[model samples]
Target: MSANIENFPGTPLSQADFDEGKILTTHWKPKLEYGWDAGVAISRYLAELKNGRLIGIKCNRCRRTVVPPRVVCEWCWEPMEAWVYLEDTGTVNTFSICYIRWDATRAKEPQIPAVIEIDGASRGAGILHLLDEVNADDVTIGMKVQAVWKPAEERSGSITDIKYFRPT
Candidate 1:
């Protein structure tokens, strides 16, 4: 087969064409709605959170307990054995002080986000949550912290049930 490079058709556009609105375009605004069903493991986890407790699943095969309970052990690929109650207390594995809000606006008080390694869970297995009641300058890895839970009446079966973690 012979190539016909010279027969190619269509005009190349320049930046000025788009900038000056030479090209035709359509605009759209879509309204969307959605819902999520937290399955077995997470449903149980959230229920425990609402009741002012932290729960995880234990993998008897690997002898590791994981928070935000999973149905199976990520490492051993075995079914998780039982639900374990984890302490709300943990150590700061890492942290960050943010000057902006989730909406991209400036914040008067910086938010402290951290990975907390829960006491009863396997090392390096933890949750990402906000920190409070401590100076940003004083926040450090290995710092001991405890969950500051919302009042029982305010608990809502969500991670936010624990308002934040703070230095213990």
Candidate 2:
């Protein structure tokens, strides 16, 4: 194979003055296992998802519903003991159209990620998920949105299992 320098024309690229280029192994690590169970709350959340329910736990003391199902309330610092069905509707608390790799596993294309305050939950209590079915130009700070869940059988015990949210 030959090296074509069209993109970086006239730029000094290290070709080693050789017939062809070679790939390098800069670093390597052994595959390993690492995980947290997230326990009953998340487990129950997954189960609820199977039933087409968006479940968040509410703090009985503060009455604030926390998405991602925390076992404790972020406000009153009390134990969260009630399961609440989020309305699947929400207002965008704030958002950004990220034009970079959101994570090591995300697609090369940029994604619109937002913190959404789902209905029936207190302000500032929200979930982080991707926004779809809307253009980056259309996304705004106060936009209303709703969840679009994957088929029940396709849901995993993870956020992506919800697919993405879109304008309501």
Candidate of highest TM-score: 1
* Candidate 2 per-residue C-alpha lDDT over 1-168 given as tens digits, one digit per residue, 9 for 90 to 100: 247544654645466733354544356798998897868788888777777777888887777777778787767878888888888889998888886673556566678889998888777888889899998898998899988988878876567777888998
Tens digit of lDDT per residue, candidate 1, span 1-168? 247566666889999988899997688998787788898899999999999999988999988889879898888999886999999999999999999987999999899999999989989889999999999999999999999999999999999999999999
What is the Cα-based TM-score of model 1? Answer: 0.83
Measured on C-alpha atoms, candidate 1 has an lDDT of 0.93
TM-scores for every predicted model: 0.83, 0.75
RMSD of 2: 8.8
In model 2, the worst 10-residue window by lDDT is 17-26
Model 2 error, position 94 (Å): 1.3
State in Å the error of residue 102, model 2. 4.6
